[model samples]
Structure formats: structure tokens, C-alpha cells
Target: MQHSTSRWTMLAGSAAVAAAMFAFPSSAALAANATLPANDHVLRVCADPNYLPYSNRAGQGFENKVAALVAKAMGRKLEYTWASYRGHGGYSNFLAENLDARKCDVVMNLPYGDHEESYTKPYYTSSYVFITRKDTHYHIRSMNSVSMHSIKIGFESDTTPETAIKLLDLINNAVAFHVASNPQASPRELLQAVQDGKVGVMITWEPAIGDFLKDYPDLQVARVPSEEYGPGLPTVGYTYGMSMGVRKGDTALKHALDKVIAREQPEITATLAQYDVKLLPNPRHVNFPNQ
Candidate 1:
């Protein structure tokens, strides 16, 4: 079953990458899909189209800036392929189509701390916050505060939400409506759940959570401090980074990408800020890594 799913995922990713490349003719061809050498004048990137605050066709998102930054640093141009990030098997599809198929050199805006995808380094760190009813006292300041009241937390599966909640031992608070399937569900779903006395919390990351609050004035998010959770669930931070997702032996490209990131960090952050994307801060550098 796993193998079959994996194969299907690969096909889906490949198709997506192909579609993206076809959509953007200006971009360079990838090694996996067509035949582009590492010495090509342009770098190919695979991104999620509908995902905002990250990458989109408008070219104003953080990931897009990162891509442009790397290109500028390397004195190369950027070509992009877009895909939809639905759920669980997403990276597999992305990897199969983009990396394995060589349609793109890097998958931008991946969660920095995620070990599953072989991340580059810690770039930006954001926090996982929840929106609860203004009237409710379910401040997500700590896990112990999560009482089994009527509070239901909306979490996107197979994401930091899953890991963050698990680390906090707040799995029981999870509301299983499947956001991936019901992409149209409003931010009000969480609010309605709380207002109707269904759930007390709706856990998600930025910038959606931030966007949700903007749209719904009544919905207030819980600003959970990182120290509120246990060690594993330490809310101290979540990272957003970019890395070159190459086939297992694609070390040469990876080395080149790392150098690009180092050189282009400043320009990337400036571009991102233009889109209202505030990257996480670090002691040495304010820019996030992976990209």
C-alpha cells in the first residue's frame, strides 16, 4: 500500500512539475524533466501556487523573493514550476516531479526544522499560534491549560501542526475536519466551532492564522509562549527555510545552493518584507535559512 501510494505520489508530482514548467515557458528546463546541466544560466524552482505569504503567481511572496535572491546572487535567472500542496504525500509528489524529474533545483518555503525532507539549515523561525474565542479562557499558553472543554482545534495534517500538537500532547484537542479536503472552509469554522461551544482552539501557523484574524474581527488567536510546552513541544520557535531538493547523490548542486543562500540572504529578506512577510530572527542573522 505504501509503495503504491508512493508511486502515485511520484506521478502526481511529476505531472504538477510538468504543468508548472509548461505554464512558465520562460523558466529553464530541469535535469529530471528535460536536460539542463548544473552550469545552466538559470535555476529551476518548484513552488506551491496557491500558497500565499510564501509563493504565488503574483511573485510577491517570500519564497518567490528567496528564489530571485538566489538567482541574483549566482548571477543566474530563475524559472519556476508551480504545484498545489494538498497534504501528507505532498513532498513525495514534489520530490518525484521536481527533484527526481529534475524539473526544479530547490523546493522553497519548506519548514526549516523538518528533518523528513533533508532541510538545508535554519533560516526563519515562526511560532505556532491558535485562535480561540475571545470569551473563552483557553489560552494556549500551556498544554496543561488544554482542558477537554468543547474546544476543538483545527489543524492541518502532516504539517508542523501535527508535530507541534503531538509535542504538546494536545492531539486529543485536534478537530478532524480535514482542511486539505475542505480547502474552502472559512476561518470562521474554527470560530463557529468555538462560538457554538464546539471547540476552544484552532491551531495553525502564520500567515493564514494572521490572515484569519484580519478577516474575522471577533476571532482572537491564542499567543502561546514557547516555554509553555514541554521540551519536545517547546514553542520557542518554528523555522522556515529553503533547500535544494536533489536526488540522493546530487551533492554538487547542493553545495552550490548553500553558497547561493549565504550570498543572497540580505536581498531575499528585503524582497520578502515587500510582501509583508516578516522572517524569523536569529542571533547572527535575521534571514531564514533553507531558501
Candidate 2:
């Protein structure tokens, strides 16, 4: 589902063209310095300001913890390049416009499993689910479950949920509700709908759901599995593996960051837990951005 932040209307291939058009020395420059610094003092990180459960300026989100882990791994202080990701094109736009501009060296909390963007390597993994009242028997553990019951499920359009429902054939049966009745809806609306019980449940990643559950005591949540995947869809639940986002051709930095993530996984997981973030069945990749 798409969030209702800025309406991200892209001109198709905008991301690719943006990359091709914005090609400059920054990508190569960072790639050259990808090696761990001898002193381990500072690692500039790009983060979203308003995205919660994942990142925020408050340094309370999972991404903040992740940044700390990376910093610790590099023996550097964590510095941030604040950006905003509020739409379909927001991520690509932020990466190209900001990170590519050399404002930051690395981007955390990106989708590692999706083909939308190339990634370094899997650092953490997670799945999506429906957050609802414990008493609600919707039992949305799979696509078939979604079809068997009459549910008014709400999600952000243009997001993973939208993509999942479209492929699952559950759209017809789902009281398919998007945050916006017309063009799109914001992330807040979906959160509100679930919190207010306007909808039986809202589809979301576990990280986001964990935060919601922490704040709201009465809600119950369930993760969908790959085995639940129906025909023509992913066999497993929507597994979101997260990795650092580096510009294309920045292989040196990507490789270095990959090693950092691999070596720091334990610390990263601990930091996330300290922030009250939950990784179901263990973090398969890293940093579930949905939260």
C-alpha cells in the first residue's frame, strides 16, 4: 500500500533516468573510500526524518539503533543526513537527490528483497502481517484466509500491501480499502484505521506492527507465511530483507558495508531490541522499513 505523504507521481523510469542523468563523481568518490577507516570515528548515514519504527530524527527508531551499530562496528560516531520518504518515488528520489549528492555515504532501512532497487547484501529479514484485535477471528495467515472471510482490510496504496493484494487475487474478496478513496492514502490513515478499529486489520510489516502493538495493548497481530502464498505469488510471506543502499557502481563501499553488517548483526539486533523493536522468527534480513 502507498502512504499518504506526498503524492509520488512518477513519470515512469524516472528512477532509472534519474540515476543515469545524475551520474557524477560522488558515486565513484565514495566507492573509493569504502574501506574501514583506520580510526573508526565517523560514518555519515542518510535517514528519513518522519518515518517511524524505521527512522526519525529522534534517534528512537530501529534505524537509529542500526546506525549506532554500524558506527560501533566502524568505531565511528553516527552522523545523519536527514531526508524524507513519503511516496512511491520517495525512496528513489531521496537516494538520488540526497545520498547521491554526497550528503551521506550510506542509506539504511531499504528493502533488500524487492527488485525496486539494488542492494548490498542481506543484513536483516522480516515479514508482513495483519495487525488486529486479538478477539477478531479474521485469522489472515494467508491469501486464502483473506478470501474466506469478509474483511475490510486497509492499506497504503502503491506499497507492498497493494502489490501483494493485486497478485493474490484477494482484491475481489477483500473489502479492499486504501487510505485514500481516490488517488492514494497516507501511512497515518492506515495506522489510524487499525488503531480505531475502523477496519478489521491493516497489512503492515512486523517492525511497524511491533511499535503499534507496544503502544496499543488490545491489538493482536499475525504474520502471513510463504506457504500461505497462493498461486502466482511468492510462496513465503512477503519476506523483506533489508540492506544498505549505495549508488550503483559503488561496489567497494557496498562490499565493505556488507562485511560491516555481517559482523555487526548481533549488535544490530540487540540495539533494535533495546528500542522495543521485534523481529519475528529472527530478522531474516534487517531493518523492516514498514514500522
Candidate 3:
């Protein structure tokens, strides 16, 4: 739940909360609204100014690079509408306040399957990964071990790792970090906890922590297996196709954005590689390749 679903929670809280924030017409209606037309001379993007590996005010994240490509291909200049992904507003409805409100026209890292908006074609897909300090030799690639019960692990709530840990009765040895938590960089907080010896392992969406690995050179990563996607109601999967989110029923804009995605895919792939964000090798047969 890093960049994509981490942006969620607000999407998953409850049906009433979800439906209250959107204008998903039974058909196309946004085309009739004049307040936020799509064909403007600028590509207005919504992003977190402090969230690294995704976006920031400095235009240094992979999403920033991808958005630049989209704007360039569309023959428009790029403009950002900054939004904080976390802190202060506890579980803020970022989409309602931004994209749906026309404050911005696109949101990258919107995981596939989000029903609140009409999203563009996926630019890249990333998986959940296991992170451990090299000095500890955690070497854990799967969540099925009996050793799981003995390790102190930090896992995101409402995600595959949480589900697997719960199913195996390993919750006692685990600390849970909510993607919807308040007032701090939750992903970095967890990793810092591990580096400080508060926890020995962490399971999180790779991009959320990938770019920050440079600060903790001793940290190592392994993809959490696909089988850990968990069970029961409201389960998010192991791998997600990352796309761009625009207003619901905004087909004109959606189509325009799709063309950019299809055309600049090679550049997008290269941008992701710059951040150590690998595209999934296989959807169902995901593996933890050596870096």
C-alpha cells in the first residue's frame, strides 16, 4: 500500500465514505462541466510534495519524470498541484479534495481497480517486498516459515503481509503500521525502526521504501511471494498495475492521457528503473530477483 493503495484507505474505509466523494456518472457527464477542461495548455498533476520515490516539490521522483513525459507528448507544459499524502488531516480524502475537485487533472501511482476515477493505462507494475538489514541475514522471501513466528516484523495493515501474518498466528511477534496513519512518513518510520533495532523485518510496497534505501545501505530487499496476497474480504493483491487517475467519466482527458502512456512507455520504464522500482517479471509468478 505504498504509492498506490497507500493513497487508498480513503478509498477503502467504507462504502458511504467512498461514494460520498465521487461523481461517477451512470454515463459521461464531466465532459459537460466547464470548470476543469482537459485540453488546457498545461498538464495539471496532483502529487505529494514530500513523498519520495513517487513525487515531491523538487521534481525528483519517478512519477515526476513520467508526468513530464506525458505533458511533453501531449504538447502541454507540466504543472503540479501539491497535496500532502499524509499527516495532519488523518485519512484525508485526497482524491475528493484534489482530482475530483478539479484542482488537478491527473494522479500517478493510482493502482488499477480504483473505481472512484477513470484511470489511464498502467505505466508500470510493482510488488510488495521484504526488507531486512544485511547484517541480520533475515533472507526471508516467503511468509510461510515457522521462523515467521519468531521474527519481529513490521507490516502494513489491510495488505497481504498483515493477512498472512494473522493467518499463521504470528501477530504476537509483529508490529502493524497503518498506511492510513497520521503525521509522519509511515514507510520511512517503519524502516527506521528496523535500522534502529526496534524491528528486524519489514514488508511493504517496494516503491514506498525503495528510493530511501540509499540512506540505509545495509538494508536488502526481496519480493514477498504472490501467494501472500491474503484471504477474506477487502484484500489488496501482491502486485498492482500502476496507472494515472483522472475524474470519473472524463473520457476525453482519459483518452488523451492513455495515448501518452502508450507512447512514452519506454521512457516510463527507464524512469522506474532509476528508482530501483522493477516492473513485475510475471503477474502471477512474481519472484524476488537479486539487485
Give candidate 3 regions above 4 Å deviation. 1-5, 8-38, 87-92, 178-180, 228-236, 285-291
In the range 6-95, model 2's lDDT, one tens digit per residue, is: 221111111211222222335565566555343336678888776666677898677887878777777778888887764334555566
User: Candidate 1: lDDT over CA atoms?
Assistant: 0.51
- Each model's TM-score? 0.65, 0.72, 0.81
Every candidate's CA RMSD: 8.1, 6.8, 5.7
Collision count of model 2: 26
> Candidate 3, which ten residues in sequence have the lowest lDDT sum?
10-19
Compared with the true structure, all predictions reach lDDT values of 0.51, 0.58, 0.68
TM-score of 1: 0.65
lDDT of 1 by residue, 200-263 (tens): 6665544443433455566675533334345453233332333445444656666777776666
C-alpha lDDT (0 to 100) for residue 137 of candidate 1: 64
List the lowest-lDDT window of 10 residues for candidate 1. 6-15
**How do all the candidates rank in terms of TM-score, highest first?**
3, 2, 1
Model 3 Cα lDDT, one tens digit per residue, 183-242 = 345467767877888778888878777777878887888876655334554433466666
